[model samples]
Target: MATPAHLNRVALRGRGARSNATGRFETYRSESFDDGWTEADEAARPLTTIIQPMKSRTIIARNDSPDIGFNASINPYRGCEHGCIYCYARPAHAYLGLSPGLDFESRLFFKPEAGRLLERELSKPGYKPQVIHIGGDTDPYQPQEKSLRVTRAVIETLARFSHPFTIITKSALITRDLDVLGPLGKAGLVRAAVSVTTLDRKLARSMEPRAATPERRIDAIRQLAAAGVPVTVMFAPSIPSLNDHEMEAVLQRAAEAGATSAGYVALRLPLEIGDLFQHWLRTDHPDRAKRVMSLVRQMRGGAVNNSEWGQRMTGEGPVAEVMNQRFLIARRKSGLDAPSQRMDVGSFKVPARAGDQLTLF
Candidate 1:
């Protein structure tokens, strides 16, 4: 991996990745150099966020990964603007022949016709009403979601058909759609999960630059629970030395704020994410970067990451076993050890669209 250039300071401010290296399949790599002619603070500008429409033929994606919770998922957006450094979804951007570093966050794509496409798919004659997870690959309520409202549209379509769904996000922006979520919750048709990595504001700001603050995320849980939503607090990507110590505290706070259940996932750095995260760790937290990586390897069986089934989400060995024990104890103490409520799939019905013939009973 290339060193983060000084230009990164100006151009990639508030972003997680330290360097924007080319994707793995690219033909050639590029690096930055500073010539003596350029003056300091001379017309250097931050990179602008570019938004584009993604022309996707289908909306729902199916997976057979046994480790994953849901089989069917939908993503309204192609990339996330939250810029979380430990995001496992980062490597997916490489499929578009784009850098998983800065480009993954800055250059984003949204499906403008997501609501229409979902309606058509749900209207299929043999369509089965199963639990569809939203924001499975990328956050549905990223920063741009506030203005684009693509996520809200999809939710409306789901509501019309009485489809069961679940959504997970780290953004406070989700609270803005309580009007839709409140009714879904009442019908047991929807559940929400908020990802609260840590209670320390500073650490969260550095690790997940554009995401909601820890305090705001806690507040979002409070609001969702108050609105009758069955909310789950997710302490995801639990980095061993850096944020592992805060897991119990995070669950406690969420439980107090009305979270019904809690879950966690160990840090996963697959593909290019390994390089991007290491670069950020060295640049931002040089004090404990070495120690953090050492602890991670101990959990991942002497490697930085492991992709084996059943052991990937929650690693193995002594360190990981200890963490799991701690989480179980904490979950019990926090009163969040109960299983989540199952969504109502039998209530699903195909909503009539405009210009359709009325049926007489």
Candidate 2:
């Protein structure tokens, strides 16, 4: 399928989405008109990322999805800058009245008071500590995090309260917090998961434009494991006929690098994500796009997506089963098939807040 002319705008370098269509909630639609003179200037200039602080009353978000591993998660940022074209979280940007395409990656929001909000929540009388996942929707350590340190602050708060937490990220920036994570990891209070989609440099650069390279992710697993942090390598969104062939290789490399656990999630194309990913595939990999979508549909039951609870994470059908078996066998061979490390919930305790009466111990 050829990309529609209106949606075939030149993809900006370092950005994943080729077009910035309007959000689904908007009533008006905007398109570009070529007067024949400005296209050159537009192509010459690069798009810049804009970030604004978001005022939020709460920090911890609780979800009761049975398939999800954790009941609560904290995202320090609203939008991710890594610009992974197949990110399942893209649809969330629509709720913000922004396009799930380019706007989901370039225009971002951060919660400057995440640490304070979390502390207040933890200090509450009825608050109960559970395994908290970081970066469940968007990457907590996206590029902006290097300077903002919002994720660092959240980690600090969790550590201070002796809460058990797990973090999933594709950025190597998580290594900078080894000072905190290393100790918490030793106490069984923290674990980490790194998503490594493909080993091919070119493919990773195209699909997850701004995330860490495959080598760096593997190295991150090594670093985390070395620091006593239990590391799990997530081979997520395993696209058919594209990066699927490298599943075994990626897992083998991660295990060699010291990853003790591993997991995978089939590609998900829900809502606006279906169109955005299709656009990216048609524009970047037109040659194999048809075959790719065909395999995806086969797994998705004749559609590009199947959001059913039991099947959304790993799809269904013969192809999906084959992928699952392959992952199981490969993980067994690589010694990553062991049960995952359990976080220590028993050690959780709320730290004393300032201005509170001192204990008479």
Candidate 3:
């Protein structure tokens, strides 16, 4: 099969994805290599990931699909730095005329005006409060967040408005914002989910190169729960024959760490993700690639992915069914679904506008 040209490069230096394959927007191709380079010199060459900032007029992205739970979501960054191999958001990079492979990881874009835009949106007339999902497309707390803090700014705006919201991330960096989240949690306006794909550190290191380790995520869960924040453990993109077997163990750990609720998403490979994932499996776990793909195809109903709304997350078929059952059993046994902590939208206060006189209802 003709796939993305693999970039034979070292795994270090914050680089992850397998290739910088041409995206859907591009009509031409671009390739780079040394003219007089020998195989030996390739190993010693140095490369670095680049960050490009972009201004976004809008901060909230609205979604109406029944499969999704939130009406509005905020993506502080366009591409994720965590570099998860099975990320469904990878294909979105194509829209920016960039590759959905390595470029999705190395070439990043953060919206610096997210907080201002969010405040402006919230100030709109008749704006109804709903729990806005943060990091719906990319990890808001991705490595870039350490300096950018756009996600933090957005959270600050939400907190000021007493807006209801939820955060989803696999980075322990979220712990840095516990001061803000703690107050919001106490106000019943916030909750969070930590995506823990697998407990195997080695597999996690290979698949989600820059994400928080499994243990640290669990620790983050513990910290959040201790701070009175509702922590939902998300076992996302559970790859069959790879890390699916650890579903119970992972949930158990989360529950022990005080996660009150849990959720799981069967691996979703849409568009270029299928090819990129296949290539990743071949390079990292060659022996299991064929079996994993076979099982994924079966779950996807003979295709690499099924875009139908409801089926996209959990998937359908025997393999998917078994995995779903396993997750449910683990959830209940772990007491993760005991009682859902609901965020309050009724208390939502409209944010302050640039120039407005205060009025009481």
Off by over 4 Å in 1: 4-6, 37-43
Q: Give the TM-score ranking, best first.
A: 1, 2, 3
Give TM-scores for every candidate, taking all chains together and pairing residue i with residue i.
0.97, 0.96, 0.94
Candidate 2 per-residue lDDT, tens place, 56-130, comes to 999999998988798899999988999999998888898899988888999999999999999999888887788
RMSD of 2: 1.9
Q: How many angstroms is residue 38 displaced in model 3 relative to the true structure, after the best TM-score fit?
A: 7.0
Stretches of model 2 off by over 4 angstroms after superposition: 1-11, 37-39
Candidate 3: segments with Cα more than 4 A from true spot: 1-6, 9-14, 30-43, 351-361
Score each candidate by Cα lDDT.
0.91, 0.90, 0.86
Model 3, C-alpha of 327: deviation from truth (Å): 1.1
Task: Kindly give the stretch of ten consecutive residues in candidate 2 with the minimal lDDT sum.
Answer: 1-10
Highest-scoring model, TM-score: 1
lDDT per residue for candidate 1 within 9-97, as digits (tens), equals 77777888877788888899775555565565652677678989999888999999989899999999987889999988899888898
